[model samples]
Target chain A: DAMVIQNPRYQVTQFGKPVTLSCSQTLNHNVMYWYQQKSSQAPKLLFHYYDKDFNNEADTPDNFQSRRPNTSFCFLDIRSPGLGDAAMYLCATSSQTFGDTQYFGPGTRLTVL
Target chain B: GESVGLHLPTLSVQEGDNSIINCAYSNSASDYFIWYKQESGKGPQFIIDIRSNMDKRQGQRVTVLLNKTVKHLSLQIAATQPGDSAVYFCAETDSNYQLIWGAGTKLIIKP
Candidate 1:
């Protein structure tokens, strides 16, 4: 099946340490997005890439960065893991023409200790 | 400001019965709406979608109804089963690009 795949379903990191989560899609969509979801909240958009053009949200912190090396892959880099940053990080893909239906990956659960 | 909210935080439904989840969006200009089902430990799965020009749309076993006047949207799931237990979210976007998501409603299926 052509779907989104996330690496390291669960990750544990020390406070202030840096961690990275990755997402790849086989669907060959033109856009990719990264979201942060807390326990009982909606998914918050962090950043997105339209082909090679990156769009970062206004509220996104400097500690967070994203890299889309190619059409199939996107990476989320957390410069310093904070306790508040512990949450499920999700990656989604959508076509430029029909970007409403976003297909998401299983997600990576980050735990900061 | 764009905001999307759900009427109820949780919904309980009996097995074999139908379930209705409701949402209210503040952005009237939003053109497209989508419904997603998220199981525990997994990302959201796309369920159905409806455009602003349409009043309703249906999928395999799901229906999405949009009321533009009230800026409300609803999702109806038929033949609710155990596997239907999950968090349901409603999202909308004007350009069908960047989506503004609503606080999800947790659906619980009871036997």
Candidate 2:
């Protein structure tokens, strides 16, 4: 099945350390997005790549960054992990034609110690 | 910033009953709306979507209703099952195409 995949479903990192989460898709969608979901809260958009253009949300922290080297792969890098950064990181993809219907991966759970 | 929000934080329904989850949006310019279901320790899954031009759209056992006048959207599930228990969210997008998500509603099934 053509779907989104995330690596290291569970990640543990020390405080102030950098961590990277990866996402790959087989659906060949033109848009890839990264969202941070805290406990009992809605998923907040961190950044997204529409083709090669990167769009970051205004409220996203400086510690969060994303890169899409190609259509099939995207990575989220946290410059310095904090205890409050523990949350589920989700990767989603959608075609430009049907941008409303986004397909999401299983998500990576990050735990900052 | 304008965003989408749900009226209720949680709901408990008996198995086989119909469930209705409501959401309100502050962005009147939103042209697209979607409903998503997120299971524990998983990502949000697309359930259904309705464009602003349409008032209703249905898929499988789920139906989405949009009321442009009040900027309200709803998801209706028929014959609710234990498997349907999860966090449900409504999202809206304008011409910018950035989705604004709502605080999800926890749907609890009572067997």
Candidate 3:
């Protein structure tokens, strides 16, 4: 099945420590997105890449950054993980521009200690 | 009792019955709408979608209704089952092409 894949389904990091989550897609979608989701809340878009063009949400914190080294792989790097950053990180891909149906991964659950 | 804000609004339904989930979107200019289902410890999965131009769209056992006048959207599920228990969310595509998401509703299935 052509699907999105995320590494380290559960991650634990110390406060102020750096952590990286990875996502790769087999769907060959041009757009890849990263979202932060806290318990019982909606998935909030942190940033996305459209074939190397990075688009960051205005409200996204500076600590969070993303890099799409290639078409199939994208990484989310948190410069300093905070306690509040403990949440599920989801990766999704859309075939084209916005309004396209997104394919999502199982998500990486981060725990900041 | 836990504070109301601590949890998502929940709807409990009996298995084999029909289920309806509702959402009120904020953008009047939103031209596209999608419904997603998120199971526990998993990312959201696309269920169905309806465009502003159309009022209704249906999929396998699922239907989405969009009311542009009221800015309301709904998802209807038939023959609810244990597998249908999950958090359902509605999202709209704004003018910027960004998806503005709604607070999700949790569905519970009773035997």
Across all candidates, the chain A TM-score values are 0.96, 0.95, 0.98
- Point out where model 2 deviates above 4 Å: B1-8
| Every candidate's lDDT | 0.90, 0.90, 0.92
Model 1: per-residue Cα lDDT over B4-108, one tens digit each: 333549899999999999999998888999999999889999999988999999998899999999999999999999999999999998654568888899999
Which ten-residue region of model 2 chain B has the weakest summed lDDT?
B1-10
Using all chains and alpha carbons, the TM-scores for the candidates as numbered come to 0.94, 0.93, 0.96
**Model 2, global lDDT:** 0.90
Comparing to the true complex, what docking class would candidate 1 get?
A: acceptable
Each prediction's total of clashing residue pairs, residues at least 3 apart in sequence or on different chains, is 0, 0, 0
Model 2 agreement with the true structure over B3-99: per-residue lDDT tens digits: 2333549899999999999999999988989999999999999899888999999999999999999999999999999999999999988667778
What are the per-residue Cα lDDT tens digits for candidate 3 across A55-79?
Answer: 9999999999999999999999999
* Clash count in backbone of candidate 3: 0
Which DockQ-derived CAPRI band holds candidate 2?
acceptable
Better of 1 and 2 by DockQ: 1
Shift in Å, residue A5, candidate 1: 0.4
TM-score of 2: 0.93
If both were scored by DockQ, which would come out higher, candidate 1 or candidate 3?
3
Measured with C-alpha atoms, the lDDT of residue A85 in candidate 1 is: 90
lDDT string, candidate 2, A10-107, tens digits: 99999999999999999989999999988778888898888999988899999999999999999999999888888899999999833458899999
Q: Every model's DockQ, to 2 decimals?
A: 0.41, 0.38, 0.52
User: Each model's interface RMSD (Å)?
Assistant: 6.8, 6.8, 4.3
